[model samples]
Target: MKITFITVGKTEDAYLKEGIEKYVKRLKHYTRLELVDIPELKNTKALTEEQQKSKEAELILKKVTSQDHLILLDENGLEFTSVQFANYINKRSVTSSANLIFVVGGPYGFDQSVYARANDKISLSRMTFSHQMVRLFFVEQLYRAYSIIKGEPYHHQ
Candidate 1:
C-alpha cells in the first residue's frame, strides 16, 4: 500500500527541510511515499482561527478519496510506542488494500469538519511541536517504524 503524507505548509527552515528529505529518501526502499504540501493560506491576519481551519480543511479534504484510510496527526489522538507504531504499520499493510493517507493540519490544528472525516488519529507526543518540526519527527518515526517492522537495527527497543 502507498503512504501519502499530507502537510499544511511547506517546511521553511533549512534544517527541518534537510531532515525531512533524509527520511523521505530512506523511505523509498520500503514503500511508495508521496509528500503533499498544501500551500499556507495567504493574508491570514483578518480571518478568525476557526475560519482559517475551515479553509484549510477544504484544501486538505480535496486530496482525499473514499478509498483512502485517512489518519490525522492530532495532539489529542492515540499515542503509541515506536514498536507499536511498527505493528500498526504491519497490520495495515497486511489487512488493507486502500491507500493510507496521513495529514498534519495547519497552526490552529484540524477543523471539526476535518476531524469528522478522519478514519483515525495519531499523536506523536503529548508535548506540542512546531508545524515544521512535526514534519521531520513524523517522517523519522515513519522510517523508524518501517525499519522496526523489517526487524532492522534502527530501533533499539
Candidate 2:
C-alpha cells in the first residue's frame, strides 16, 4: 500500500529538510511514499488557540480522501516497538481499504474534529519534539519499519 505523511507547516531548517528527504527516498524503495505539507495559518497572532487549531484542521482535512486510512501522530496515542510497527504496516497493506495516511498536526495539536476522523493514532515517543523534527523522525521510522519487514540489515534488535 502507498504511505503518505501529511503534516502542517513547512520545514524551514535546511538540515531537517535534508534528513527528511533522505528517509523519504529510502522509504520509496519499499512503498509509494510521499510527504504532503499543509501551509501554516497566517496572522495567527490574533486568533485563539482553538481558532488556530480549527483553521489548521480545515486545511488538513481537505487533503484527506474518503478512501484513506487516517492515522494521527498524537502524544497520547499507542506506542509500538519497531517490529510491531512493521507488522502493523504489513496488516494495513494486506487489509486496508485505501492508502495508509499518517498525519502530524500543528504545534497546539489537533482539533476535536480531526481527532474524531482518525482511525488510529501512534506516538513516536513520550518526549515532545518540534513538529518539524517529528517529520524526520517519522520518516526514518517508516524506513526502519520497511527494512524490518523485509529482513534487511538496516534495523537490529
Candidate 3:
C-alpha cells in the first residue's frame, strides 16, 4: 500500500528538511511514500485558535478521499513500541484502502471535524515537539517500522 504523510506548513529549518528528505528516500525502498504539505493559514493574528484550526482543517480535508484510510498523529493518540508500530503498519496494509494517509496538524492541533474523520490516531511521544519537527520524526519512524517489518536489522530491542 502507498503511505502518505499530510502535514501543515513548510519545513523551514534546513536541517529538518534534509532529515525528512533522507527518510522519505529510505522509505520509498519499501513502499510508495507521498509527502504533501498544506499551506499554513494566512493573517491568523485576528483569528482565535479554534478559528485557525477550523480553517486549517478545511485545507486538510480537501486532500483526503473516501478511499483513503485517515490517521492523525496526535499527542493523545495511541502510543506503541517500534515493533508494535511495524505490526500496525502491516495490519493496515491488509485493509481495503489503497492509501494509508497520516496527518499532522498545525500548532493548535486538529479541529473537531478532522478528528471525527480520522480512522485512527497515533502518538509519537508524550512530550510535545514542534509540528515541523514531527514530520522528520514520523518519517524516520516510518523508515524504522519498515526496516523492522523486513527483519533488516535496522532496529534492536
Candidate 2 per-residue C-alpha lDDT over 1-157 given as tens digits, one digit per residue, 9 for 90 to 100: 7888999989999999999889888887899987899989889999999999999999889988888999999999999999999999989998875998999999899999999999999999999999989999999999999999899999989
Index of the highest-TM-score prediction:
1
TM-score of 1: 0.98
What RMSD does each model have against the real structure?
0.7, 0.8, 0.9
| Per-residue lDDT of model 1, residues 19-127, tens digit only | 9999999999999999999999999999999999999999999999989999999989999999999999889999999899999999999999999999999999999
lDDT of 1: 0.96
The TM-score between candidate 2 and the true structure equals: 0.97
lDDT for each candidate structure: 0.96, 0.92, 0.93
What's the true lDDT of residue 90 in model 1?
89
Q: Which runs in model 2 stand beyond 4 Å of their true positions?
A: none
Give lDDT: candidate 2, residue 147.
96
How many clashes does the backbone of model 3 have? 0
